[model samples]
Target: MEYRIEKDLLGEIKVPKEAYYGIHTVRACNNFPVSGLRTHPALIRAIARVKQAAALANMSAGLLDRRVGDAICRAAEEVAGGGLADQFIVDPFQGGAGTSTNMNVNEVIANRAIELLGGQKGDYRLVHPLEHVNLSQSTNDVYPTALRVAAIGMVLELSDCLAGLQAAFQEKEAEFAGILKVGRTEMQDAVPVTLGQEFSAFAEGIARDRWRLYKVEERLRQVNLGGTAVGTGLNADPKYIYAVIEELRAITGYGLARAENTVDLTQNADVFVEVSGLLKAAAVNLSKIAGDLRLLSSGPLGGLAELKLPQVQPGSSIMPGKVNPVIPEMVTQVAFQVMGNDQVIAMAAAAGQLELNAFMPLIAHNLLQSLELLINAVNIFSEKCVKGIKADEERCRRWLEESHSFITALTPHLGYDRAAELVKKAMAEKRLLREVIIESGLFTAGELELIFTPGELTRPGVAGAKLLEKKG
Candidate 1:
């Protein structure tokens, strides 16, 4: 519990003598106690990678002391490896467009690098945080670049999780491919469809989501790494500016490129808005599929009872024998949150004034949170719900057979007006259409039988017509 004094333009402050973070980070901790949430570890790792790339670039340009640069590189490597995660204490909701986060990384790397040089943590004479650690950078450029890097990693993870979910749905589609169920529109039975077909649609929606997630990565990979201080490159050396981006590409193994219009990249946060919109679209699809699963698996008795989601936990404490679709419910909640986060990102993106978006901390926090939540939700939904779902074959068959929508199959033969009248009469009388059709004497029983087979009814091409042609 020892301390040392570190001063900035504001004033001097006592920093823990052993803390890798120095006065600036301490100031940030005191200033922004807003969220009580720490910056994401992914973002911290990305910032450290930026610092590592900057150190290497500085050395390559002969702008830094070789021993000092080497030490800084080693410190940054450790931080990027997540060795010093506990030392990053700034809240994600801070002001100054993530300057607090940027400085927090700078101070931590500078102090640790000083230790590697056999100097005390607070010894600025050996390694100054601002002069050495923060060379050729500004929060305006570095923070957003780091955010992009972090987001790229997160998006990839979510994409993988979504792919898993899509595959789970496809597996279920195959499992239930033969189970005939009634399709509905406006809550009324319209026609017959296979349970497998419903799940195939779900998988297709998620496949589109996976494709969208992949496409947005290219947008994020265009970064303003060399555009220090409002994209003018400012006091940064030209050689360092050009070389740092290449070093960053090597460090991250991402296809990162410096922005073609650095100033526009610095001033506008619209790309994050675009990414959030795409996430919102995916959330919509997830929510819709979850809602459908909930409806299809509603009750063992009174509901559709066509699907039985894996019971993960007891649905109620007092309602005996209750098992809820908690996995899909959880995914629905995640979708709600993602939709809300998209709004936050939109407002934050629009709130940017001239040279920089002062709202980046909020944008970064919400975007990363959305990604993490979606990844977890998708993974759990696949494992706990979709993978274990079972179709009620008898229930699906009964509903499909009982529905008056079977009149659809006869429309081509009996004509639309006659089929509509037959459907109305059968539904009103609570009579099976097969019995009604047989009693009505519109077609022979053999022809009706051929037309009403599950494959002939649900699939294209009329088996009854083919039967008639062969008979002739």
Candidate 2:
């Protein structure tokens, strides 16, 4: 089948009807399968923004007729609503300077617009892809601009997830307020602390992640739209830049502004790297929390056994009463993937040599995949692991009471030499440190009781209250 050529301000380009089909067009079309990663939701959303901006620009410029503008706007609205996002299956890791992905979205929006106009597929004869749909944009500008908009959208979702997770930890903080366990340092018991303090620390880590995501979103809000074709604005009208940015901000509801230096915007992808790094930090925090949960829930028979994870599924094929903390395990795996994806993003960002970053497809794939995974992982961790977590209060108290390391807290009052002697004797005899302290003549039984009370040791104010109230 013969195909027609379409010319833009750049030059004439031939796209075959058989090979270059509409958005709904799919075949054995596997030639440009570079990254094999599909275009991200952020990229798709950005494409919608591009379409919206083009329509608005044309309407203002008196270039596009109202019928064409309205058709493009309506189609763009559908794309923005994510109706046509699934059709954008171009591999994110493709070559052709992201032209394939760009053209893929263009084709989809154009065909959808054509249908809206009561026209047939490949009916760019009425609403040309370059002339009407793409308008005064190039892949260089549009792809990156869409990327910025999409990143902002994703960051917003991540923000919500982080907030939810943070809140979940905060709730756990309240639930475990009085539960005391032996704190570990260098993997050895150190002192007594309320489990609430641990949960509060987890919440603080998530809050830091939330702050980093917000900062990354601020950088992503600066887009490269007006930097048409190598940041020169060669063929684009002077007013196209500001007008498109305004329209995109309205369309996306993000605080998007034009890049201060369009040349730098076109060439640099460091913002993506910064965002990816923040995601890595967030993933690390997640993995740390997961590690804590797994350790806390390690054994009902052998391990620490200080806390009980909510049992969601059976743990073993052979064991009858077995349960596992699968949610934290799954979150740990997600964190691992996020960390690896960050490496990919770092490499892609660094591979940008001179003019422009050619690895945008990879950058977009890794970054978006990280964001999506983290959001889902955070949701799962909050709902399955954190919200359902219950303090094993009796077990916690037993561990705290049994731990010889609580002697460290008494050392301040008993002197380090006496405390060390008591610990050595307790370890040798396998007796409770409280019992050893009382028997060793370092303190009387009543004095040992006063100093070794779990309530006073874990809750600072309790010790103060005992001293102030002259407890019997």
**Candidate 1 on 120-176: residue-level lDDT in tens?**
999988888888888888988999999999999999888899999999999998988
| Native-to-model Cα distance after best TM-score fit, residue 103 in candidate 1, in Å | 0.8
Pairs in clash, predicted candidate 1: none
Q: Residue 169, candidate 2: how far off, in angstroms? A: 1.1
Position 374, candidate 1: lDDT: 94
Best by lDDT: 1
TM-score of 2: 0.91
Off by over 4 Å in 1: 461-463, 470-472
Once fitted onto the true fold, the runs of candidate 2 whose alpha carbons sit more than 4 angstroms away are 1-28, 34-37, 453-455, 458-472
Which candidate number would show the highest TM-score if scored against the true structure? 1
Predicted candidate 1, C-alpha RMSD: 1.5
- Worst 10 contiguous positions by lDDT, candidate 2: 20-29
Task: Tell how far residue 436 is off in model 1, in angstroms.
Answer: 1.2
